[model samples]
Target: MSSAKVWTIAETSGRRLKPVSYELPARGRMLADKLGTRLASVVIGDQVDRNDLQELFWRGVDEIYLVTHPELAGFLVENYSNVLIALIKTYRPEIIIAAATTTGRTLMPHVAVRLPAGLTADCTELDIEEETGNLLQTRPAIGGNILATIKTPHHRPQMATVRPKSTKPLPRDESRSGLIHIVKFNPNWIDGRVKKVGMRQIEETGAGIQDTDVVIAGGKGLKKGENFSLLRELAMLLGGVVGASREAVDRGWISYPHQVGLSGKTVTPKLYLAAGISGAIQHLAGMKTAEVIVAVNSDPEAPIFKVADFGIVGDLFTVLPAFISRLKGGKAK
Candidate 1:
């Protein structure tokens, strides 16, 4: 008998799978390794992208369950919850891991209520207690005053929604193979409540939030709102996005859409270039998961460099313009 199975939601955008799907399998490995059981992933959508799924196998998922239905194309809270609740009744996993994202934040609570299980939201870390085989759900509490460690002692499947960029992604190993199970999905079962409403994909001006590989983030070091244009130029030159520190947003230097921190959005872009940013703890809480972090700050002792994979000591005004000019093949460094 399987000791425990892990369930994860696979988010899809216009038939393309989102990157968060890869995160759960890596997280499942962490749980299964401790529990000594299998880590399973469930994909719910109208169709499955076989090519995008190859990465899941490489990341150490034991089983992948695919649920397809016409009404499941977009995010339908009722349909998703019902289908997932049914799966939980059937498999009875010891733990269910979901991303602490917009859709997930809305969906997991409903499922938890239906199953009557304890749910942990925005968990920064997940681990299994070696002796008890229990899931340890850790998250910040009381306005970041305390770090709370919680467990679902009586619940069968302890559910948790983890923040993106909170954990390291496992490297892909192509040699490892896994099992794939296709679950039967009936369109009529969910055709009533779930309707495919108007779908419009909002495109970011300079960067696509979903697929940006590199990001150049700015902080209060900028003197005025006009300074963001420099960050944008550098980002465009590097084929990256322009991110903003919470301070910059609060100061009206940039819009909240570009702000990144605990209160803002979480990003796991490959390379994060932080300029003129002091790197507050709240800001660090968000983008700490970048594969390679490069900090460029005038203050030689800024905290941003602490988590940076690479650090550059300089002034953003002088540094960025020079970098852009060099990239544009105009002037010498």
Candidate 2:
């Protein structure tokens, strides 16, 4: 029934497999099953840990292509893309999916250009067309206003990059069976144009924003940058992290990393508490997937309330402190 295989790129960071990497296998497995083909994953890095390999199998990867080279130890766009381009040429897979994280967003496009394949970015959903067996890539298009489904009918390897939190990983099964094949390639394929001469890793407290259980985000309603401390206090009390809207960052109230919106990061926390942010469509696009949304605004007609599960039409200055007091053993559930 199937002619070829469904492939996904498994990415690692900080020397461990990123959570988003597992998400690819979860999504790729479903499509592979529909096409009656096996799901294979390719990981490119200098080091491949044994534990990480087993973790991929647990997530339902049937085979692993270990693409490694001394030059790939550091992420150079040219080197990484060349390795994948070679792999794609050799395997000629039917479909290729990757995580929509920074690495994947940068890497896939380079490979696509070399292979001259049709590629889509930031896809929220993926499916297989029963009649044509085409890879149906669905994503938010045109300023996140409409959902668009794109198909690469003419491309040999249908390619797509999936948003990190859009899908969940399959449960890990230690008993799952699979194989790891080390891939060898010519080191001369690399062209040293861009180089990573220096790097700094800032430690962000709490779990990652996308994966956090609770997120406390502020916006223009805060009135001033200094007020972010109020948010930080509440975040610490709640065992959560602080998030911000584009306006807050634009006003120099917070750093860019904490921003949440279409122009920023997409987050899917279990509980999202928004303060002073008048739910712009762009802001909503980033956090709409959160399981539970709580909004606090001075205006009852604020757009954030339209999507929030619970809303308080009042001043965030008062509401935030009150919540902090109540949670700090005062008397508020």
lDDT of each: 0.79, 0.85
In the predicted model 2, the residue pairs found to clash are none
For residues 164-201, what per-residue lDDT tens digits would candidate 1 score against the true structure? 54555579888977777777775544737546668554
Q: How would you encode candidate 2's per-residue C-alpha lDDT over 1-333 as one tens digit per residue?
A: 223389989887746777887888999999999999888898888776778888888998988888776677767778888888888788779899998777888989999988899999988889999999999998887666789999999987999998776677898888897877778867776888888889765455523676567789999999998898898988888778899999999998888888898888888777899999999999999888788999999999999999999999998988888888888975657
Error of 1 at 104 (Å): 2.3
Clash pairs for candidate 1: none
Q: Considering summed lDDT, which 10 consecutive residues are worst modelled in model 2?
A: 202-211
